[model samples]
Target: MNKLISELRRTALVAGDRVALSGEHEQFTYTGLIVAVDNLAEELSQRGVRRAALIADNSPAWIAVDLACLQAGVALIPIPAFFSAEQLEHTLTSCGADTLISDRRASDAQIASVLAGSTATSAFESQPQFRLWSLAVADQAASLPLGTVKLTYTSGSTGAPKGVCLSADKLFATAAALNTALLATPLQRHLAVLPLATLLENVAGVYAGLLRGAEVILPRVQSLGWAGSSGMEISDLTSCIDHWQPDSAVLLPQILKGLIAIAEQGHWQPPTSLQYLAVGGARVAPEQISQARDLGLPVYEGYGLSECGSVVSLNTPAAERAGSAGKILSHCDVDISDGQVMVKGNVYLGYLGGAELDSNDILATGDIGELDDEGFLWLKGRSKNLLVSSYGRNISPEWPESELLAYAGVGQCLVIGDAEAYCSALIFVTPGYSYEDIGRYIRECNQRLPDYAQIRRWAALPKRLTVADGMLTANGRIKRDVILHTYPELVAHCYPGIVYPIGGSQRAFTPTQTMNSQTDIDT
Candidate 1:
């Protein structure tokens, strides 16, 4: 129980006949994987490169490095492929990482340039040589404990990425907790759709998959058309799902939406082998899950944050609540305090910005949520995103956006902050969709919403916000600041109007008070 490597090594000894890891191009038996890890451990030990960064996409190599790091005690770091160049550079600098492993086929000149300039923390006096290797880059290894494993950075853009210091015990605790929950089902085979850098995936996807004696499938992000398209494109996803046929996978809600669309279009049939599609990152519509299930996709939602070691609350096949992120797991204690989630368990040791869990030990999750009597968690929205109107009522954009997403014409919504003017929204219409068609649809949709919650005025944007542009997470949460800054003109056209109810043949409602002619669209 020292490291995941030990468990994997032991399993490989007995499960040598079983398939341990699979990729778009390569598949390895348990024995083959153990040997690969042993070989890489030997090579890395020689290079004097104990600590390594696996910045590459999901592949056999990624899993190999992960295992190799454990075997050699190199203390590895997995870099999310969705990170921006600035975010990427900051992670490299923060981690004091001396070597990086990347996908050869996917590496662009720009990433190489970024790698060359990447520096280790200046504090480390006996720093090892920093280098970058493509997937094709030959194997090499150097040492153990990678000399007090450096910090792991999150996907947050608020500041220079804060490093989360984890101990061997903390990660081990996470694996044990997750393994106990999964019951180590041997018939399991996990297809990883999320980036391995995600704690949710690394712990629950890779480690859990391995410890369960499941074959972990790592599909190529590029082949899945994750390169140019928003990572959730349906056709590409259909192709990958058909090819890999994993028993389970952790999916973000955005990815679930695409999978739902694929089912709706009858473009593909979800694999008969598929089970346990764990959707998270944002609230998922129950209807979306139900529709997928009707079409034979075993999709459901779960809840976790990076700071909590990922698996805080999950909906399992054994025990599930359709609309709720099911019972909080035994590993952690979740309590609802003033509508916020407070967690205490084997969470992060501390953050780089010097934020420690208060003596109370509850990780103050800014999200507003409630716990049901059955212990299922129902999320309201972020307290920071709450919009209080002139009438003194708090309205969250997520509620309205969630409603709008249930409709067909809507693609993205940014409920605006307008206390003085009125509660307004900046809506991004879907691609090739006309305002007239959307307006007609929203007109019908208005019958379902209350007058105050109705979107008053909204404008169509030319395109969606992208991860590369810093306007989205890999999971596609609307980066509100980026949306407002990038589409200031669009927001200006939508607010402070006397909105009329949809489909009603009414001119408009008379204004009770004079307001700004056009909203400034500033956050």
Candidate 2:
């Protein structure tokens, strides 16, 4: 595998040359990017800054520091822009970061001092001691690392962050997987629709775009209807695509749905040069793919996690699977044991703060899946997240939730009866929708489901799902545990008493009994 820095150096030799990256941000030629990285690398080394945390909005420099890490061999931790101040404090301190990087707009001294103090072990809940630097100033002293590349955290440690260590070579290897999958040669152009911080998008979206020598487009967040500073906006995305016209890109399921919506509204046109649309991060409804296809979009499903440097499986332009998260990429060595997906190759070194990963460094992904006769993999559900009823039956909630989405005005629904007395759900309906109408809609939806699989009762959440509320991920999947934790009252209404398992002496129902929709409504 080519080390990340070496690849950049090789690509930059021609200078003023090189193509778009991952078909998103129209970054500088290899020569320009190399020079910038080299300069940044020198600046960091001169200051003797071995490790730094990158906290900033979307910008070309964000990725520069990322690549500079590869060159300097210093590990980089990227905090998502959407992370709250509290979340940020925990992540930075937990990672023991020494230097902090941010944009011009975020040059608050108090915030900087607080962040710097987090690195000190003694700081604990208090901020550590460190130096904060703004993007405007160029460090006179920078050096490139010949070692580890980057460290990313994903909700693993509960309170503190867990780091996934990816070497420059592995990061580059992940990018290489896409070159073949995307048919991305020197001529293609890709766009970065998702955040650059995510390992999945960072590796596949940006690095893959570069491997093909393609132009990468990254539009402003505001243009995309991202009301907050964190996620991408639809308006910005459509505008970027219409203006630059990229060939390939990566997106989450919801973004694909949004594109389909825009096309249905006749507001955007599918690019003539466009080829692959990689979708992943959460379970994408099969119908969502069909709907996008009806609008002339070629959206391919994918599956991955931060530990795998983002991509584990992708449906390449060559071997396409409609519903399955394409075949495992060349970079990942995947196997299914006992209905669970286990992967090892290119796995992260360990979590942050010196805690070791599971035995054998193999990530036994909790996600349940199966490989078909043709070898295409389809996801079923999460093992840990599976809901078990008081009646001793385990239920895969996603199976039922996907069915609910097909109903009009049914925005989001969470099946929450795991280890509980009876099955119930917490639903977030489409804006301005009435709970009365939703009840009718769910009743109809339930009629189509088996008795065991049907939701017995439901409660409407007062608020819409949002990242701010921790109810949704960046891709818009319900944060199951977070939702339940925030709305215990709603949860309790469905399962009134402590869930008790049915005894062995339980008897069968009488022949005179008739079916009922929910126990709430007396039959």
Candidate 3:
């Protein structure tokens, strides 16, 4: 039996009437949650659901289905709602998922179209404010790693997302480590801000909260102000935080930025009840972290990937550095190899439909980082994203981009200038910021960076990169390749006299350089 499931059973036995989960409209005690998991597990087992895929918003039902799969020893795959239809089709087919559970609002016709020509039958079950469906698909030949309990698909530097297979042991171990790091206890109330499909939130928020027997809040995404992957209503988020008064929450850097903006505008102050606010998913500026702290937000930065079961290191109150990802979690062994971050313990089983990896093999994380004397890990940037200037100077775009992001006006910034004289940026400004204002902000950020890494030129993007636009991963990381492909003209405009190669040596354009007829560049 999974240790997490065993822990859940123990919690139910010890705190039968203690609230385990709460939604916007409903609540469940530990005993009630256990009973629901048993009922759903029985139902799924009777239907021969060896592998199940879940596509739904955050809710009590979503938690129940996930726990039920673990209870029944069934492999569970979580499909991010932000996924494109084509991506979704690829994941469902590649994983050979034999069963699917989704919310009712999800278009049946659309799902059927994605699953068309496959031998699958669907049935609906009525639930409060949400409808559940059980789908039986044709048996697949693909085999999973032994003891596989979850498969999470990540959008790599490719069109098709790859599924990372994981086991309950590794997941629960990480959760326990996080619980210990955060000093979480049964009295903690965790509010789910990120989607439950996100591995970080799933393990760090829900799983860790459950391990501590804390109340996990799983409200609908819309209720918390999220519209798809990129849009947010800060007012709604603050209101929800005020109403829930949660002690813990996980957030992306962008969300943390938004909250800081709200607080800076004197519109709201984060409730004092918020004890632990984990911000990650991208490089965050230390200045932003300081600002959040000054605003009474106990924001901590962490780092991880799906291959590491979500969290490898985190900045707990006990062990934290100002500009580092934090100390390595007790459950994993981390080291720097050839300037790249490598992790060994608690590594993923393997990609779905791929060969299983030896548990002892050190996984080479593409991110480059170093460990401080105090054991705090400082992330530089993705090794693949290292920008080499024409003068043979190497720069990590994330370094300067982080400084740029510290400004209140800049919403999203991508630095790109490989083999060029200096760096340039594609920026998306927060609403109400003018080009001149943003230019001033960039200049201010430039003062904090080296000359070679300063933003020499920049163009304002009409829209922010987002999952809906296929320019961001489901976890909110920018898809650099996708953005470069989608906006070649804009990128070219940033370098009027430079002919940047897509995948080869860079060449200089002729003297009669004619910039693309697009938005004006700020220098």
Candidate 1 segments exceeding 4 Å error? 105-107, 117-151, 184-187, 353-360, 386-523
Best by lDDT: 3
lDDT of each: 0.64, 0.63, 0.78
Output the number of the TM-score-best candidate: 3
lDDT per residue for candidate 2 within 8-85, as digits (tens), equals: 677677544764332223356677777777877776776666677776545555666677766775668776554445
lDDT of residue 502 for candidate 3: 62
Candidate 1 per-residue C-alpha lDDT over 1-523 given as tens digits, one digit per residue, 9 for 90 to 100: 3566777778888878799888866788888887877887777776666557776667777777676776776767776554556556666555556676555322464256554544433211111222344222122321222223425655442324456656555566665666665563333778777666767777778877887788888887766656421234668877877887777887765567667777778777888888677776666678878988998888767777666776788777776888887778877888889889888876665664354543247788787889988878888777686554432223566766776677666887677743422346565667776556666665554444433345655555556668997878999887887666666555545643334234323222222223222222222
lDDT tens string, model 3, 227-292? 655457878989999999999899877678778889999999888898889887776779989999
TM-score of each: 0.68, 0.67, 0.74
